[model samples]
Target: MKFGDIIVAMSIIAIVIIIIIPVPKSALDILLSFNISLALLILLISMYIEDSLQISIFPSLLLITTLFRLSLNISTTRYILSEADAGKVIEAFGEFVIRGNAVVGFIIFLIIVIIQFIVITKGAERVAEVAARFTLDAMPGKQMAIDADLNSGLISEEEARQRRKEIQREADFYGAMDGASKFVKGDAIASIVITIINIAAGFTIGIIINNMSFLEALNKYVLLTVGDGLVSQIPALLISTATGIVVTRAASDTNMGNDVLKQLFAYHRVMFIIGSVLLVLGLLTPLPNIPYIILSSSFFLIGYQIHSRLKISTEEEKEIAEEAEVEEVKSPENVMSLLKVEDIELEFGYGIIPLADANQGGDLLDRIVMIRRQIALELGIIVPMVRLRDNIQLNPNEYVVKIKGIEISKGEVLFDHYLAMNPGTAEGDIEGVETTEPAFGLPAKWITEEEREKAEVLGYTVVDPPSVISTHLTEIIKRHAHELLNRQDVKKLIDNVKEEHPALVDEVVPNVLSIGEIQKVLANLLKENISIRDMVTILETLADNAPITRDPDILTEHVRQSMSRYITKKYTQGNKINVITLDGELEQLIMESINQTETGTHLTLDPNTIQRILNSLSMNVEKFTSIGEQPIVLTAPIVRIYFKRITEHAIKDLIVLSYNELEPSVEIQSLGMVTLK
Candidate 1:
């Protein structure tokens, strides 16, 4: 081991040896002095530490110090009983400090024991017990808060883990302190008992074995006994007081000394009142006039100094604030700073801040991180970091989700309540503030926490405010995932694919198609709620088809057909897929309207025909919704994109897929045909 570790181990071993063997008077004196010095050092260190956990080793230290003192007491008692003299340290305390009076020395030692045991040690033990209990009880809530922060992206996983470790250390420290306080109490009792035994037994030894007179025995033995008690009790008192200080310490950046001065002297008015009271007391009392005058004068002067310092400090703060404002206005960088925008941003009103703030126990940042990860896994698109900001201009309960500086979705949430939604089969209506679910626009009600369990029992889905906001954010990002897929994102996907499928990437990217072309295809897939995670299939399909047609639209269609199994699995319900299709005549009309040119294919259908087709599709979509089925329109490969474009605004949740995109293993169950009257 290291030198310091060796020294500590040897010292502890020596303490055990001291208990078993008698030490010489000189060695006893040195150890006694060291004991007092060490106790004082511990007290000073405890006073300076800002947090109790800063000195987490204090419990073990308390145990060691208590043992050391007890060992010294035993060693000194041996010498006093055997040789009728403990040491010079004990003799000096007996003769000079207590003036050779055994009764007075005994009384002083008793008083120290009472104070240490009855007052300081008892209070500290109780406080440590309560602290440990409360810390343990609050651990689950604290851990949940940490998880929320981790999910919200406010802190990284490593930071959250460190915070959790600190919390555990805090609980362990208090629990250890609770047990260690018993050591101090037991040591105090041992000191008192040892003193009584030494006095009683030493007198017998002095008279019977040493053949000394009764008066001589009384003087020699009692002095030695009382002296030993005072020596041991002084150090024990100091340590008990130190233990109290350590356990009661609060966590702060400032030390005990700074906190005392700042908090105790914060107000000059209190000092001034105290000074005035002292002045009045001095005038009315019959005590020594000069001493009173000096004391009162000192208070007045100190109060005035504090008042003047406070005034100067206030003025300096105002000056600093004004200077900051002036600098902010004068600097051109402040204006330029506003020009830069985050890729994805979540702006919440003042009331919704608690949902995002880690300090307030909101886990919105952590939820956003999870949302990003979920999107990346499901859509194969690495979502950009979502920046959370507060906007006071909006209503308190409102929040807006933005993409590339544009507001894509906005919603409202109640922070102190839960949202209860009927799972479509509730027996009766619940009393609550009616509102729409922000995520899906389904009818919901804001209910108090007390009603959450009841709502759950009634088969109503209950969600907290943070979950609501997070869900809304998740849905909005999924809907706009295509918009977030830029050239840089495409490059990242390519690099990631390069690790496992380097040849496939090389064949398609820069060789068959550029990054821009790939971005368009990926964006097209994302817009249709299709996962681009199957990059091998996507790239291979593009590599085969790009030679014949350099069109992104046609290339995307080809990629979709290759990913038929994936698309089909999503729309499939158990063994069959229910779908709406166009009649043969309607399909022919759409095909006839397609005008191929050098630029691309264009639809030249009449407005009346488009209107009739939209109306028919809308009716079918509504019919699917009433039956609780998502409407998926099956069409010819040439018209799927065109049909989707025409009906996107009219039917937001409509899914248009080409016949080529259907898996052969899945059976298609056609619901109806969308034919014009």
Candidate 2:
């Protein structure tokens, strides 16, 4: 064991022994002096700590100190009764306080005990109890705030963990202090009882055993008894005051002494007013003029000096700020900071501010939070924080959604109005301003509050202005989710999956394919609105086929085939799907035009043939839409990915599937076929 640890252990054992063993008067005096010194040190330490957690061990320390004081009282009582003296320290304390009068000295000792027990100890105990309760009550809120910051990327996982640990430590410290405060109270009561016993027993012993007269015994033992009480009570009072200071302390950047000096004298005007009041009282009232005049003059001098120093410092600060501003403009880091772009941003005009402001009863901010959570559940990728700010450059009712600093889509909403769109089944017409829905480009109208109910009754879908903007933003994010999936996001997904399937992640991540390759495959899936939440299957598929070809496109096709049941359930209704099929000639044509290179595969078909293929596919896709079914094209497994890529620009919402990427239980009905007609 370390030397300090050994000494602490030995000292505690010796303190317990001191209560039983007889000690020489000289050694008792030294031990008594040490007790007073230790109390003083504890008081100083309590005053300097910035936070209660800094002295988390104080509860245990308080118990030990109280025990030590009681032990000393026992030892002193033994000596005063048997030897007619406790030690020089106790004797000196008695002589200093008694001053030839025992009653007055004894009364002063009682006053100190009352103050320590009734005022300081009682107040500290109550504050500790309240503090402990408040700390425990606020723990849930503090933990939630940490989690919010972690999810929003404002703090790292390590930082969140540290904050949670500090919160727990604070709760533990206050709880222990609540119980430790009772020790101080108990020690005070014990001290009073012990002092009374010392006087009564010593008085009896002195007269009978030492052959002293009544008056002589009364004077001798009373003096020694009072001295012993003073010696013990003084240290007790100091420690009680320390206990109060510790429980009441709050977290701060500086120690208690500095905080007091700064906060108490924060306003120079208060000092000036005090000085004026004192000056008037000294001149007009019958109070002692000299003392008041001296104090008033000192206050006025200090206030004037403080005002002058503040003025000088303010000017110096302004000059330093100007210089720093110029230097900041010249710094490279400032320029670099300006280049940092958010992953997603929602900018709206002043009229739409209420939709994002919680104070205005707008739940757009809340809706955006739900949007992020929904995307995570559906796509299995964490969406970054969506920055919302008002833009003065746009119209009052206009809003724009941006991805990676570029505007992707913009929409307009009328405040205090609802947008109503017909779903091809509305039987009646509604009077409102005509508009096109930004999310789906369907014809809609801005209707008044009274017209909202009427429109809904006529089979029209109605939504509030905030919902209109929220839906538009949600669609824009979903469309561009592929662009947002980077290597870092892929790594986070891999780490999450690693918690469950460590060996699968280890085999597929860096060994079979790198993070960039995995990111590309996930992006491919997201581009088609496929959910990557089933990460284990995705990793397993990659582990099987990644060695054959490092192409992300090929790997993604393998993953899709493996997730046939999920895709079938997503698109099929009533165990049936209506889709367009590629003709045998068209499939063979695509297979022939496929060109391979070192980087990856590509289609080298001539422009004329591509346009003819697009025209034929467009005609076949229109047949499904005419029958109220979604446009799905069924092609061979080898040509499905290439066909989707070829028509992505011409047909944005096309769903091209392979025959193998379907459940056998579902029936596929081909409504038409794309042919080279």
Candidate 3:
């Protein structure tokens, strides 16, 4: 064991020993002096600490000190009752402090007991219990705040974890303190009982055993008993005061003395008013004038000094601020900061500021936090922090979403109106301002709150302004999510997988495929709107087939087949999938056109052939859209990748799935065929 650990163990052991074993007067005196010194040190430390956690060990310390004090009481009682002399410390207190009056000394000791037990210890105990209860109650809200910060990218995962740990520690500290305060209360009670017993028992023993008169017995024994009570209670009082200070201490950046002085004297006006009042009371009333006049002058002088100091300080601060502003403009770092590009930015106009400000009842930031979490669950990748900026350059209702400093999509919202779309089932049209739904480019109209219920009654889908913007932002992020996946993000994902499947990661990363290669595979999956949350299966598939082909495209295709169950469940409606299929000849022609090179595979189809294929695919896809079904293309495994490369730019929401990428149990109905004429 370390030296400190051994010392603490021995100290606790020695406290227990002191209760049983008799000691010399000199040794007892030293222990008494040490106890007093230790209590004073604890009190000073409590005053200096800015936070309760700074003295987290204090709860345990309180128990030990209480026990030590009780043990000393036992030793001193033995010396008083049997030998009639506890030590020089006890005797001196009896002789000098009591001044030969036992009754008065006992009364003073009773007052100290009442103050420590009823005032300080009782109040500290109540404060500790309430603190613990409040801390426990606020835990859920604090945890959610940390999660929101993590989701919004205001803090890193490590910072969130540290904050959560700190909150738990705080709760535990308060809970322990709640129990430890009882030790102080019990110590106070024990002191009174022990002092009474020492006096009564010592007086009887002196009269009967030593053959002394009643007055003589009372003089020696009662004096010693009162002295012992005073010595023990004095230290106990200090400890009890320290406990109150600790439980009541608020979070601060300075010690208690500084805080008290700064806050108490913060207002010079109050000081001056008090000084004037004291002057009037001294002059008009029959009160003594010298002390009152002297105090009044002191207060007035302090107020004047404080006012002058504040004025000078304010002027100096103004000058320093001016210098800092000039220095900031001259600094090269200022220019460099402007060059930094946000990965995802949502820049809106001033009219929409209320949507981002929480104080104004805006849930846009909260919605953004949910959007990030939604994206993570859907894509299995953490979306970068979305920076919300107010731009005066745009129109009051206009907002734009940017990816890597380039505008990807823009939308406009009516601050006080709702966008209502017909969904093809509405019975009639409503009179409103005509506008296009920004998310999907559908024709819609902006209506007021009065018209929202009427529009809904007419079978129209109505959405508020914030939802409109949030939906548009979500779509834009989903579309460009692949652009946000870099090697570093891929590494983070790989590390998370490694924690659970170390051998799988070790086999696949660098040994089978590089991080760049894995990033490409993940990006490809994200581009196709496939969820990579089943990372174990994806890695397992890669580990199986990576040796045969190092191409990310081919590896991605394998991972897709392995995730067939998920894809099947995601796209299937009523246990059936509606899809367009490629004609066998077209599939063959596309597969044959694929060119293999040192870099990777690519389709080398002539422009004419590519045009015919896209035209045929679009025509077949329209059939699914006519029935309000999502358009998906089913093709042979080899032709699926190359065919998607051809039609992705032409079809906005095209979903191409190979036969191998579907579950065997699901039924597929072919809506149309993409045959090149």
Candidate 4:
């Protein structure tokens, strides 16, 4: 241990020694003065600390100081009964107060004890108990708030960790204080017992053993006992007051001193009212008018001074604000700052804030973190951090999800109601406000809490407001995953891959294709709902095909075929894959219309033919949807890209796959053939 630790340990040992060993009067006087000084110092420090956690060591300190005071009381009591002199400190206190009246001195000592035990110590103990209970109770909510901030990207991981530590420390501190207050109470009772014993024992020893008279013994012993009690009780009172201050303190940037002044004197009118009350009392009461007159005049003067200072402070603040405005107008950077946009933002109206607030039992932030992880696992894309904020301009029940400053999807949720979606096979109709599900365009209803069990009995999927919004956000992000990917994201992916596949990345990147080209390939795969998580296979496929074609579209097709097993497993059900195919005549016509250029390939099919193809595809897709099967259009490998491009705008959720992208073990169940009449 360091020297400081050694000193603290030795000091505690000394306090224990003081209880068992006799001390000289001079030494006792020095220790008594030191004890008083220590208590005063602690009180001053407590007043200056902004937060109770900042002085977390106070509970332990309280225990040590209490022990120290008790040890001194014991040592002084020993000398008073045996030697008739406790210390100069005690003797001086007795002489200063008792003069010749021991009764007055005893009463004063009793008053100090009563104040410390009944008022300060009791109040502090109560506050500490309440604080500890509430701190423990609020721990879960506080932890959730930290997690929420972390998920919302409002605080970094390090900050979140620090905040969590602070919360735990606060709980521990308050709990310690709750136990430590007992030590003070015990010390108070001990002092009273020790003082009584000192007086009784000293009187017996002096009158019976030393041959002194009863009155003389009483005069000497009573004065010494009262002095010793006064000396101990005064410091005890100070320490108790300090304990109260520390436990009752709130977290703030300002210390207790400044906070008290600011809150107490914030309004000058309070002082004015006090002055008026004092003036009225002085006029009506029978007490001396001079003291009240002086007090009221002081109050009026202080009030005027405070009012003037407030006015000056306001004017200075206005001047500073005006200067800031002028500076902001002149700065070009400030003007340009307005044009900056967030990558992804979730803007909710006022009514939806409670769903995001952790204190109100909202887990939206935690859900957002899960959504990001889910996207990364499903699509192999590290989604940008989503920023959540409140926007009053939108309707109270509405929320908008935006990407790159443009709105992608918007939805409304009733905060107090659950969205109950009817499963197709549900038996009975339930009473609720009819509405459309925000995440999917499914028919749903907003039902009250009491109707939740009834809705479930009817085979409805019940979801809360936060779940509805989060589900919609997750889907929106998945659909726009390609748009969210940038060259930076590709670079990060490559860096991550370098750890495991170093040689693969070093050879392919900047050797055959640039990061931008790789980004395009990833985007292309994401656009088709393909997970690029198998980076090694994708890179190897690109390495093999880069020499054959520099086009990203063609490269993506090559990667897709390589990942055919992964793709087929995702959409395949058991051994059968339901599919829609193009007729041989239509396929031949599409092949003839394909044109290759320096930029890329293009399909030159007539608009009428495209319309006819779309109508037929739509009919088949609807038939597949009605049967609860997702429609996948199967086409020849050569025309797959062209066919997907032609139908993408007209069919939102259509899945177009080439024959080469299917697994060999899978059986293709042809549902229908698309042919123009």
Which window of 10 residues has the lowest lDDT sum in candidate 2? 144-153
| Tens-digit lDDT track of model 4 for 243-320 | 999988887799988998888878889999999988888889997888888899988998999999999999999999
Looking at model 3, residue 288 earns an lDDT score of 99
With a 3 Å backbone cut-off (N, CA, C), the pairs that clash in candidate 3 are: none
Weakest ten-residue segment in model 3 by summed lDDT: 144-153
Estimated TM-score for each candidate? 0.68, 0.84, 0.93, 0.70
lDDT (10s digit) by residue, model 1, range 261-347? 888877777877887777777788886667767777777787788899989999999999999999999999999989997678888
* TM match of model 1 to true structure: 0.68
- Model 4: clashing residue pairs? none
* TM-score of structure candidate 2: 0.84
Per-residue lDDT of candidate 2, residues 1-677 (tens digit):
55998899899998999999987889889988988999999999999988877778899999999989988898998888888978789889988988988788888878888998899989999999999999999999788666656544578768988999999999998999999999999998998899889878877888778998887887788788888888888888899899999988877888889999788776788888888999899999999998888888888887888788889999999999999999998999998988989888889999999887666877776677678889988888888778788999999999999999999889999999999999999989999999999999999999999999999999999999988987898888889889998888899999999998999999997988999999999999999999999999999999999999999998999999999999999999999988899889999999988889999889878888889989998887777777788999999998999999889999997999999999998898988898888
RMSD of each: 7.9, 4.2, 2.6, 7.0
Ranked by TM-score, the better of candidates 2 and 3 is 3
Give the poorly placed runs of model 3, Cα more than 4 Å off: 20-25, 137-160, 269-271, 279-285, 424-431
Model 2 ranges with Cα > 4 A deviation: 1-38, 51-102, 129-236, 246-252, 266-269, 359-363, 421-432, 447-462, 499-501, 573-578
- Which candidate ranks first by TM-score, i.e. highest? 3
Give the TM-score ranking, best first: 3, 2, 4, 1
Candidate 3 accuracy as lDDT: 0.90
Q: Please estimate how well model 1 matches the true structure, expressed as its whole-model Cα lDDT.
A: 0.86
